[model samples]
Target: MLPPRLNDGGRTDLDLATLRRATFGLKLGAGVTLISLAIVEKLANPEMARAMLEQEPLLNLLAPFGVSADAFAVVAGSVELLLGLLVISGALPQVVAILTAVPFTATLALFGATEFLGHLPLYGVLLSFLVLGSLEETSHSLSGLRRRAGVPTH
Candidate 1:
């Protein structure tokens, strides 16, 4: 299928359908990872959460708020869990993607180059989500193709 033309009357060969599928995969992957990490830090291994809070950057960030490390950990975990659920559910994905990006960007800034390099793949996915917006139902799937071709399904 020929790619659609842009509003500016410019033409390109980008396969939007394939791009959307790739974005969905990225979103699902990030969501699952976030949920799993949240569960592990908050429940499966509380000690790890405590140790994470002891990191210099986190300590500095939390110092002004007078919030206890444990409390911060709980709140952070809860936020991650909620964000993961929202992302996976495809609820306001563009907005959720931005929301997710804020903290991720902050963490990258806080930790500097090492983290920035390590999280390059995640950054790409987040950028793709921001640019692509929400995933819409497309008629390119097998079921849709079959329906379009007047094929009977049992």
Candidate 2:
């Protein structure tokens, strides 16, 4: 019981539209939650972040470079906060997703399998958003604003 315009080639374009909107809404909610969590974990509990960094075995390599673990924690937390905002913005999903994965990749390498397994689901979710979100659907970001203002996406 579907209209012809929505039932092309035996596929329900209407159903696909519903699915897309549902998934997008889920991603948006997830992005907001992530932003809030990152702020709390990284910014509010910076000592905890530094302690976690101290637990990383690979910090040994950076010690010779005089890298202060506390400072690194602050920088990392700031970057995480920014990336969390980017995720919520939904601009250039592919680029944002890839950037968001970088810290986790470092964490996996530095902290080993436990860390990787803990964050694997996050990576998977980001990948899913990147793969499923179409560029045309990203009209709520700064880039989108620029586009609406007659500026180039670049």
Decoy 1 TM-score against native: 0.67
Angstrom error of the Cα, residue 94, model 1: value is 1.8
Clashing pairs in 1: none
Question: What global local distance difference test value does model 2 have?
Answer: 0.65
69-109 per-residue lDDT for model 1 (tens digits): 77777777888888887766655656877898777788776
- The CA lDDT of each predicted structure is 0.65, 0.65
Candidate 2 lDDT over 54-149, as tens digits, reads 676464335567867766666666777778777766677778888888767876666689988888778886876676554444433322332356
Looking at candidate 1, what is the lDDT of residue 88? Answer: 69
Q: List the residue pairs that clash in candidate 2.
A: none
Error of 2 at 89 (Å): 0.7
Stretches > 4 Å off in candidate 2: 1-20, 57-65, 134-154
User: What TM-score, to 2 decimals, does candidate 2 have?
Assistant: 0.65
